[model samples]
Target: MARVRANPQFCSSKNEWKMKNNNERTAAVLGLGMMGATLAKLLLAAGYEVTVWNRNKDKSALLAEAGATVADSPGAAVNAGQVIVMCVHDYAAATSILSQTEQSGWKGKVLVQLTSGSPAEAEQQEQWAEALGARYLDGAIQAAPQQMGREDTPLFLSGKNAAWDQALPVLKVFAGSPEWLGIPAGLASSVDLATLSGIYGTMMGFFHGARIMEHAGFPVDKYAALLSGILGTFGEFIQLEGQLVHQNRFEKSESPMSISVDATARILRQAQESGIHDKFPRYVAGAFREAADKGLANEELAAMIKVLRG
Candidate 1:
């Protein structure tokens, strides 16, 4: 067990006396998939009495090897620990666990859900958990299991301030990077979904580019090397996009709508001329066209989302 002793006064706003008593805290994991397994291992490694429960019995073997106690049912799993952590597939899976666990009693226990879903759905579960006398915390892990307990890994949490403060010390063990998003459970999901979209969208765009590059006879190895460098410089996008989003200011700074639209159109045209399939670049150009059509030709590419969303 790895000892991660935090200061008693780490969360000064909360009762310092209570923080000290949080030691020897037991943790429960309701899922045994990769993400859940990673979480369970972290809790065990951090010296917590970890209880694990998975729908399938075979999934709990590795966790058992790590000195975790397996529960026969989700209710038993939650009953075994003060903190019950869940990262199941979706709302339906959550419901399956919840319906069964509520009968087993979930009073005064902290239920931290790190599952992936929309903000609205998170709130729904939060409300449902509250009705069952459980403290609900919604979280979105930005890092994978391998990054758990390591430095620079980020995880977003949102819930009641008091509950978050109470859980921080125990929760921080598995989270290299942590962001407390405030009382609303849905807020974390909103940020998470936004990030997930950008990540996947970029990957999809890059896939098309990689395919096209391979077809064009560019040594793809160099492109992978070059890709990192190109993406590494997108910090400006975060800054500019934040301002454009928060202030509704979409005035062009670097690449204007007309310029990007023209460039993307050219890329699509080139792909079409080469008898290659091109949808990603065309969709990018389509977004630019929306901004241009709105007479915001001077705005940046990020502004197109706002325009199209509007």
Candidate 2:
């Protein structure tokens, strides 16, 4: 068992006293996948008495050897700690475990769900936990297992103020600053989905660019390296574009929509000429063409959001 030590206060509000008074030195982890196991290990290393449970008991061996109490059942794990962190495959797996747990033991517990799920699932889970008298917090871990416990690791959380206060110390073990989006439990999941879209959208463009490099006989590694070098500047541009969209001020500033319109068309044309797949380029070009037709060619690149809104 890990040593129990008084957690240092991290908040300056009135809830500071309550947080210190209710500081829990025990935590329960209700999943053993890579992310879940990483969380449990971090908690244990922080000197918390960690209780862990997984569907496959064999997965608990390493954690048990590292001074963790391996619970035979989810209910047992829940009963062992005041703060219960659940990070499973999906909402379905999490729901199955919830169904098997003793509902009565949930009262007064802080249930932090780090599972990847839809906003609706998070909303529903929050309601379910509230009905059982548990403080529910929905969180999205925006980092991989190896990225855990980093000062810059992104962890978005949303829940009641009291719940946030109660879980602050435990959350800090994983992230130096856990971003509390708002009181709505679904906010974290919604942000997670939006960020995922950005990631996949960039990936689609990268794949098409890779094809272009391959067809042109250019070194793909050089292309990738160039992208890596310019990504920071590109990210700043993206942030500016996001601001423009958020403020609904799309007046041409840095880059005009007409530029992307021409660029995307050239990409599509090249795809056709090279006899490579054109689906990605076609979709991108089609969007820009639509925006151009909508008289947004003179606007900023982020004016594309107007078309997206439609």
Best by TM-score: 2
- Kindly provide the TM-score of model 1 when superposed on the true structure, using C-alpha atoms: 0.88
Tens digits of per-residue lDDT, candidate 2, 1-310, equal: 2222223331223134336555367789999999999999898777776789998888888887776778878899898889999999999999999999898999988899999999899989999999999999999999989999999999999988888888889999999989999878999999999999999999888878898899889998999998889889999999999999999999999999999999999999999988999999999999999999999999999999999999
lDDT of each: 0.78, 0.88
* Per-residue error (Å), model 1, residue 58: 1.9
Which pairs, if any, clash in model 2?
none
Highest lDDT model number: 2
Off by over 4 Å in 2: 1-23
After superposing candidate 1 on the true structure, give the runs of residues whose Cα lies further than 4 Å from its correct spot. Answer: 1-24, 300-302
